[model samples]
Target: MTSADRLWPFLCPSHPDHDDQSLNPVAADAPSLVNLECSRVLVCVAENDLLKERGWLYYQELGRRGWIGVVEIQETQGEDHGFHLYALGNEKAQDMIKRLAAFFNREMPPLL
Candidate 1:
């Protein structure tokens, strides 16, 4: 088996080189800032050497407007972007899922 096949089974279970394309148009616009007014917003960002450099700026912009409801940063020390997806059995991904679940539960409780 190839290394990517062995490492990231979910990303490309059958073909390691397959391209999966998905986009969020709303998240790509400047006016997308209004979307953060929700009761809670979970931002899962990795501490990639390059990506992490933008974290502070993102945090500052989001925090300054007081529009964000919740912010979570995953610090993957010595790791690069897309580590969670690459590391199939990564603890950070699991933890992030759990945290997101909790946040949704708290923010959007079930109807009585």
Candidate 2:
């Protein structure tokens, strides 16, 4: 199981409204992927993050389901989850920010 799958229960521990499928989109039925409402999607993942697998899974599912939207996954080399938040001065973090800006503005440069 992916780290996100393993941690779903604890995300809202002691709460009555815990939905196991809430944490991982891959947990839902395959056909349900069509229900995701978006014309574009960007999944940013850290190369060394424990949850990176989940990001990949979600990205793959979008393609496997033949969803009618552009989906992209960008992996930041040598970074951990949330590194952009913790190390804003890092070059990789700055690159990620620029990439995100490009994604938001629909100006995604061809992935290098």
Candidate 3:
């Protein structure tokens, strides 16, 4: 079982007054998400990383709520956490850098 599965209560704490004191910050702020006037989000996950599922889940949950202006998730197959950082000259690392630049340079869509 995943740590989240094992420590569900601690991660998503329940308060008597219904105020969330969740260990997961995203979960805590999920219900009141806002300030997406023209912002976009990009999430990168390493395929072989232990926390990969959580990263994807966070992206999916954000999209499902329609809170963020736009959310994108990219996966680097056969990679583990920090692979890009440690393997600077690797193809995947270079690709990641290019993607990041493109994402940063992309024009934001006009708010409707």
Report the Cα RMSD per candidate: 9.0, 5.1, 5.0
Clashing pairs in 2: none
In order of appearance, the predictions have TM-scores of 0.50, 0.77, 0.70
Better lDDT candidate (1, 2): 2
- Per-prediction count of colliding residue pairs? 0, 0, 0
Report the lDDT tens digits of candidate 3 across residue range 1-112. 6644555555455542222324232565444445455578788889887667877876776666667578899899999977899988999999998999999999997656
Task: Report clash pairs, candidate 3.
Answer: none
**Candidate 3: misplaced stretches above 4 Å?**
3-25, 28-31, 36-38, 110-112
TM-score of 2: 0.77
- Looking at candidate 1, what is the lDDT of residue 39? 55
- TM-score, candidate 1, is 0.50
Q: Candidate 2 — worst ten consecutive residues by lDDT sum?
A: 14-23
lDDT tens digits, residue span 1-112, model 2: 6565456556767532333355457664333777777678999999998778878988998888767778989998888999999988999999999999988987434422
Question: Which run of 10 residues does model 3 get worst, by summed lDDT?
Answer: 16-25
Number of residue pairs clashing in candidate 3, backbone atoms closer than 3 angstroms, sequence gap of 3 or more or interchain: 0
